[model samples]
Target: MERKKNISMAVIRRLPKYNRYLKELLRTDVDRISSKELGERIGFTASQIRQDLNCFGDFGQQGYGYNVKELLNEINGILGLAKEYKMIIIGAGNIGQAIANYTNFERLAFNLAGIFDVNPKLIGLKIRDVEVKDIDELAGFLKATPIDIGVICVSENSAQTVCDMMVSNGVKGIWNFAPVDLEVPKEIIVENVHLSESLLTLSCLMNDRTYS
Candidate 1:
């Protein structure tokens, strides 16, 4: 896929949502859908959907809107879902274990290569058949395994160290579930998933609605 220049974060973020909705539509046996119809289902305007998709290239026909299978394939390629990515979790706590157990990752081509933790108790335990290796082995493991993504599920204190270790060992993408912002080179892409922050945001919105 050609690198898209100047794509907004908002648009980049929506691509996955689009892929998800399209997948659901496929399961329903919906072959093709117009922009107006898709917008109604996904909460975006027909014009907005077209504009968002056009950031990469024109995908829909002038009258036909979009072919669901073709559009899904195109979006998959755009999101790098077409390639199988090897990823590992830096911590094997509840969140890390849950993520390792998720079956969706395999469907999306994100192979859980391994899981790691500093706790000796967790080491050698299997979460969904992926053994929790000692965190001390992470460095050596990366040297031999060609992992593309590193998931940081450690505490805030250990997040930076784990992120740095992953980057230094040639991991290009970091999915940080740890609550701290990690400092990495600009070339290394980081997606921070602040679960508490999202929950708090929801709380704030509900509070505002109560006051309104």
Candidate 2:
């Protein structure tokens, strides 16, 4: 496996887009697809697709294009989708509950180990099939459970503290949905998903498209 540090974040980010289109192609029973055909469907140019994929490894033949299922599996492996990652969510709020209810995580090999919150009212509640646990139990829970990822959906004020706790307790990755930016050691892999920022960026692009 190639070291992730050698690849640009730009290439890494486009991986999910490729995976999504490949899955769609599978649903339509498309066995093979050329870069040109995939680009037409996904809005990326053929050259860009080829270049991005080449960074990881050569996946397609010059005349043969790519085997749809084979390419999907390769991309999935590159993205660590084949490994079952156990994750826990902190802050059983609206965003947290929504994440817990997401059915696609299992398909992607990310298992929800537990959900946590400080609220006494939510402690016994269940989101999807996972029971909500008290936030106070998080320290002990991490000791017992082999959690690969910690997801933060808490308010800005509490986000950092929760993240620090997760990291200190041996969590390898973090999927942070909190509004604030977290400061962590270089070793911790963190992906910050700022929903409001994405929506605002979309709104700006839409207005720009309309004006142009």
Worst lDDT run of 10 residues, candidate 2, spans: 1-10
TM-score of each: 0.96, 0.94
Give me the candidate number with maximum TM-score.
1
Model 2, range 69-179, lDDT digits (tens) per residue? 999999999888877999999999899998898899988888999999999999999888789999999999999998999999999999999999999999989999999
Please give the TM-score that candidate 1 achieves against the real structure: 0.96
lDDT of each: 0.93, 0.92
The parts of candidate 2 lying over 4 Å away from their true place are 1-5, 210-212
Model 2 accuracy (lDDT, Cα): 0.92
Instruction: Tell me the TM-score of model 2.
Output: 0.94
